[model samples]
Target: MNQIDFITEIQKHEPKMFGLAISILKNRDLAKDGLQESAIKLWNQRDYFQKVKNKQAYCMQIIKNWCYDELKRKVNNHLRLQDDEEVEEGIGNEKDHVNDTYRRIKSLIEKLPSKQRLIIQLKDFEGLDFEEISNALKMEQGSVRVNLSRARKRLKEMYLEQENKIKMIQNEE
Candidate 1:
């Protein structure tokens, strides 16, 4: 796309892109860096990007790929990030319950198979429709729906399992 079109497209999806980065990286700083790097990468590939039919989906894909790459690099290098702490510590306050629920859901999401987790993030968190998610992930729309359904079911099962364990512990105590 041309400069104006590219900039417009990126800006339109910037928030969602950043959200995707945050979901994958789980760190604001790394998300920001990933976003910037993705932008640079997109800019470098502008010529090829010009022929892309779904610019937003393409952009999202780039962000997702970069985040995964960064994660793999960290793991390969045995790099420890400060933000990799467990979320079990109660943030203890008025919002503790809400925070805890959010953390628990996020933790469960991370447990999902990578493709299913990514599909969930794209559809639920990024507010992308099945077709959009399909384009972003290069999967068929039917496949996208199937993956989302499976991810939701898995999340619900996991949440209930965790709740049951917590309840049993409380009862024992």
Candidate 2:
């Protein structure tokens, strides 16, 4: 791809890629840095872009790989820390139930196994089809679908269990 086309393509998936980075890194600043790094890497490999079938999947895979590498480096350096405040901004002093629900679901997702969590994020958040997810995750399409199904089922079960616990607490109160 040419310069303009390559840039346009990257911009098209920028938001989803950023979201993936943030989800993995859990910090806005680091996510931004990851995106910049991924962009530079993509630019360097632009010549080979012509051979890529699903550029979106390829972009996501790159971001995922880079984020994992960053996480490993941080772990090795003993610098792994939570960026709770920067994770999801504007949650302070708000009476928004939707935001609460979002947080709860996000936490539930975080509790999922690595493959299922990644598949759920890729399919639901990034809006990638099974084939794209399979390509990005390097899994079979059937495996991707099965993992997504299991993830959704597990999330629903967890949500219901939480609700039940809330109800029990209310009853005790």
Candidate 3:
């Protein structure tokens, strides 16, 4: 496609690209940096777009790689740190049961294995199909399906375990 067409197509999926970056990085600033870098890379490599079967999947793959690289750099540099203030802000409105539930689920998701977490995020949160996920992650389609299934099963089990624990605590009370 031409520059205008490419820019237009990319604009359509920019939000999703940024969302995926944010989900992986867990820091808005880092996610924005990743997105910007990915966008620039995409623009520079626009020629490859003609050969790509799925543009969105290709773009996502770029963003995912950038986030993974950033994560690795952080790990190597020992730069990873949780922002307690951010977590505290999120929990401020404890009266909102829905928000509490959301936070619990989010925490559970963060506990999942990295591969399972990415699969769950891509398939469930980003609403990508098996083909897209496989392409983006460079995995076989069957592997992608299996990973997603296992992730969902694990998440369900964790949720049930937490529910049971809550019930037990309530009963004790």
Which residue pairs clash within candidate 3?
A: none
lDDT of 2 by residue, 48-152 (tens): 875788888889899989999999999999996576552254766665676777778888888899778888887797677887678766889999989999999
Full ranking by lDDT:
1, 2, 3
Indicate which candidate wins on TM-score: 2
Give the alpha-carbon lDDT of every model.
Answer: 0.85, 0.84, 0.82
lDDT tens digits by residue: candidate 3, 104-173: 8778888899788888987887787888778778899999888888989999999999999999999999
lDDT for residue 151 in candidate 1, whole number 0-100:
97
Give the runs in model 1 whose Cα sits over 4 Å from its true position. 1-6, 45-51, 75-94
Superposed by TM-score, candidate 2 places the C-alpha of residue 115 at a distance from the truth, in angstroms, of 1.7
Residue pairs whose backbone atoms clash in candidate 2? none
For candidate 1, report its TM-score.
0.77
Ranking by TM-score: 2, 3, 1
Q: How do all models score by TM-score?
A: 0.77, 0.86, 0.84
How high a TM-score does candidate 2 get?
A: 0.86
What candidate 2 gets wrong by more than 4 Å, as runs, is 81-83, 86-95
Residue 117, model 2: lDDT of 84
Q: To one decimal, what is the Cα RMSD in angstroms of model 2 from the true structure?
A: 2.4
